[model samples]
Target: RKQLLAREMGLEPPATVELQESDKEIDPLQVSVLSVSSFIAQMRTVVGDGEATESARAQAARQLVRLAEAGVPGADPEQWWATQTVAEERPLNNKPRLSPSRIEALLKCPLNAMLKDTADNNSDKYHLVRGNLAHAYMEALGRGADEELARRETVEAFEKIQTSPTWKRAQERDEFEQLLVRTNQWIQETRGVLELVDVEVRVDVESEPGVRITGYMDRLERAVGEGGEEGGLRVIDLKTGSSKPSDEETSAHPQLMAYQLVLAHGELQQEGGLTKVVSSSQGEERDGATLVYPGTDTKKIGTADQARKGDEELAEFAALLPPLLDELAGPRVTARISPECDRCPLKPICPVQAEGKVTTDVNA
Candidate 1:
């Protein structure tokens, strides 16, 4: 403090005081200033994937165009936008590769699926943090990190991610000890029977031309069948949510089925077509999927979903893709009112709920 005061007063500093230069690395706490390109990128996101009116996220198309016209370098609005007739026109991606959960959503209620952001939203920070930490912890474990190290890393990551709003919402989260405990429980649930082959497996399989199923399995494991026989590839999907879907629901789970489909047909995009590493470890047979919930079952492990040998179900799921693709290629989307609609954020403004019909015009 005395040294700083002397320096400020233009007085000679103490001999012991030494100045230090900082390295190129910016502190994580430092808020990043947006460059022109970054501004253009964010503006592109707002105009592209942002909600119909937002959280009221009306697309920022005009702003994007303005940026481009105003000579902002690399500001290509067209690249971000779906092919549209003109500015401010909302057009769907003619061929978007979808996740399995999205396929389920499309099956349940097209309107709700189309309207709701299936991925994380602004207010869902708590779930996002919890899920991320849990996955990271498990992933570390899969990569052979000991219990203590994984726990410490997860807790530290959670603390670093906490902001005022996140802290408030995450009050129920017990300093991530509970999440780590859940992670341990999930690891135990594996029972040493399922050999961990890989973590974070990415797959992009074409159900049909221009219609593809894209998803990431949490982990891939080799299971042992009855009587000590070596089993085929089993996909493990980790869930951090409290709500446990029933066995029947698991059997028909579009997401689980989709992962199975990936096992059967999808290429492991990261590995350049599931090279000898994946192919050698995981034999041809699709041993199906298991939903590992590492959050709710703290006292005792829950009866998690295990959907096996989904060939018939996979066929049915694939069969529906063609018709769904047909719908996507067209302008209008029909909403099949189901339980899923109950959770749609657009329910209040949805035309189906208001006028008993499917229409993008929320006010109508």
Candidate 2:
């Protein structure tokens, strides 16, 4: 800096003054001045090291205590939290109405499923906000609101929340416009088959005598096949996340199957389930479900995954839920470690994985 200043002033930099470039490698063993905190921390490390002698560790421990007694910055007793007795975790006793999403979570990890509502879910709220707002906007559009009206109405609703993470109203509004464009383009290019009828429709049905299933369907659409032949009602599930489910997963998606179960069994028979929602019902069964993905990629506005619906398949999937939920609701919930474990935020308090997974084990 001195040399640079001298050169800037047009005086030749002194030959004795030299500054090492920032890119130069630093010597690891080079001694440097230590702050009181750093020195105390080093002493602590020495005290804790297994290789350190008993006498040396004892001396270091004494020094730490002495520092704590003194008004030292590092060795404060108040820093250590008082440990409390942890409550014993038990499985849920009462049966929960298995929502489509909840079923999916339980299928992955019942422990996760059980704790999500209670735990401090550190999942990305930004994406969640965007997803919710997008849904509202899409719903508004589906219900015959114009583009601008939908965007405005969505923002007005979002702004009503008293507490939320910081994402500007203007930014959300702009993104709503982008979502509107992408979803429209996506519908034209990929999701042209199903026409949107209902948005955010709830399906609550006691499929079995004891067990119940429920979820909010993103949209209920009538499938328009070749020659404009109106097919059965198709469940339209919108996914606003960065990653969409694989083709295979989408085909056998439990959530869609669950929704279709309600559809197939005529649980949603009120208000003319098929005829009222769409004029041309033809009294046909649910054809299938479509999972729409509005891509982050602008050039490709549309991406989708389809799940075929059959009464037998839907029935079979529905049958599996009661036993699974019953097992999960009990004390013996199994933690099925899968790819999602890598992204799960509950690891620190997770009953199974709180002590950390084997870092070196290939199978783990």
Candidate 3:
């Protein structure tokens, strides 16, 4: 009976199938910025079988262009001249060395880095130019830039940009007055906080050959006293935007981590520099900025008052910066998916998504 059963089982032996990974390596090619579809297809091919995978990948590639076009809907031929005029240019290193936003942009997408770094300097849109003038005006008030000139320049710049020439509103005069009032309020508040007065000022400073980092510090206080080293300097950065994040999202924000890393290096190497990012966004209506230090079980709020005290707290915070920076530079044993990916320019080429995996007719 046992022999009969064994023979019966052997009669329907499971089929043995062999799978081999092709040793043939794909050649590395520079992906074209224009050919995002091709980039998606190439990514799928890297991790798939040659046949069915190719067809799936091609379909995926076509979907990307369709999605992108749908998002913008359409382009105008009249604006073609402006678009071509601002064609991508060479990378600029003038990134605010202390701001996490700038660092995060570089890390999240180097292509964005390439785009920003090489941006066409000539495309001076009215709003961008106006905002820049306003920011500079504010910074000048902070830096004590020629007082009369700063005030006059700011007022002149604001008037031209307060509202579009094509726009007419019944409340335009009232709104414009309110803006001037607010600007004056900010200037008055700034005057009180700037005590170092005239000390060769700098922002986004760097020490050569040691480490490469950039940020936009609000001020670099250079006065020496009981709290100051002969070469000691204080770095403070301004935040015009909100600082809150959901509990989970706050933990991995690269901007704050990168800022801490740059400052920490200076602290560790005795470069006499200590940095603090001050959240200056303060108004009943405005959501103030907050600094979420890496690995810290606590969060720091940056009200206008907190920003005022930033210079005083530099020494105390320096002790905490080094360890925090180490956490940032540490090996990543886990991969995290950032939700910010949805709007990321490279979403089409993301390796994890396997987005464009349709088989293609190379002959077609």
Candidate 4:
């Protein structure tokens, strides 16, 4: 009918088209599907075909060259090189120096970790500011500041921090005052046991030759034995947050585990020239790590067994670092949408969040 209409309109009739089903089963190998590179190659063939007009051929050639130079979308050259096989081992362009926070970030969401590092988002979040202030105050107090002096210094530090443009908001100022009061109370309660051997002590370990894991112990205390000799050590981390970490949380805590590993391997003593202290009792060892919530009467202490397990877990994570780093360095990474996304500053720009995978926690 279309051919007859075209003839009546003084135009050439359309060519007859026939539809046919193949006798042979469908073969994926025979299908015509082009990847970016394959499409470029096919275009190059078109460019070289002598039957095509010079202008058409030139256009095809130009497109092929432009695509080749641009390369594939979302393809990382470094990642490709890292994954390729080589005759001799070469040091990676990017070494995987890790910390507990980074490990946790990677576990929660690889995309989050990558974006957090690259994007300058949420640098001045209230939670971050609060946490930093608490850490600074604790560090100063642990360094042997007298009660009167520490309190004054903490206030001064808080004032100094508030001077920053990011923290100048009235609401932040109100929260800061409340946090300061809680911090001061915590200091008074823990003053009796605040004899810290080291404050903000750095622990650096080459878990594997090139895989370096490093973190800082918030406070370290020596346990004196019956003979008045130094016994085991207690690693303590101060928590300003309301939520008290559970026993399970403390047991699997990577930061505390990293500290434990440094102590277990005698690296802490070697690095600081500290004495190797053991428990005074017949069998019990006071050597362990704990998260102390100063304002509250809550403490999450890791058992000796849990400490050992933490060391093992950290070692396993360190061993897996090389490949994990490579994967994260790649352009493609997994973005998990969970309750955590609610607090993630990157949510606005996150593809997964845009897809409506994010949901608010009713309990929260």
The prediction achieving the highest lDDT against the true structure is: 2
How does model 3 fare in lDDT? 0.39
lDDT of 3 by residue, 28-118 (tens): 5632344544544443343243564454445544544454566532222222222233333333332323234554554544443334334
TM-score of each: 0.64, 0.62, 0.39, 0.55
Candidate 1 lDDT over 11-52, as tens digits, reads: 455666444566445576433345876656555555556354
Query: Model 3 — which ten-residue stretch has the worst lDDT?
Result: 280-289
Worst 10 residues of 4 by lDDT: 276-285
* lDDT for each residue of candidate 2 in 228-314, tens digit (9 for 90 to 100): 888777877777754766778877887777767667554334464432221122323777777766746456754554555666777
Q: Provide the clashing-pair count of each candidate structure.
A: 3, 0, 28, 0
List model 4 lDDT by residue over 1-364, tens digit each: 4465345334456797774566346676544454765555455555667996676566665665565567744233232322344433443335556664566677677778777655554545545666777777777666656756665666556665554466466665655555555655654554444445777767666555555556666777665555667656667776666666677877777666655555654344434444332212132223667676544533432222234444456567456566556645554466787778877767765757753332312121
* Every model: Cα RMSD to truth: 19.9, 12.6, 17.2, 11.4
Which candidate would rank higher by lDDT, 2 or 4? 2
C-alpha lDDT (0 to 100) for residue 92 of candidate 4: 35
Model 4 residue 198 CA deviation in Å:
0.4
If the candidates were sorted by their lDDT against the true structure, best first, what order would they fall in?
2, 1, 4, 3
Evaluation by lDDT, superior candidate among 3 and 4:
4
Model 3, runs deviating above 4 Å:
1-101, 107-128, 143-152, 158-165, 168-184, 190-194, 197-210, 214-216, 221-234, 240-337, 345-364
Model 2, residue 255: what's the lDDT? Answer: 75
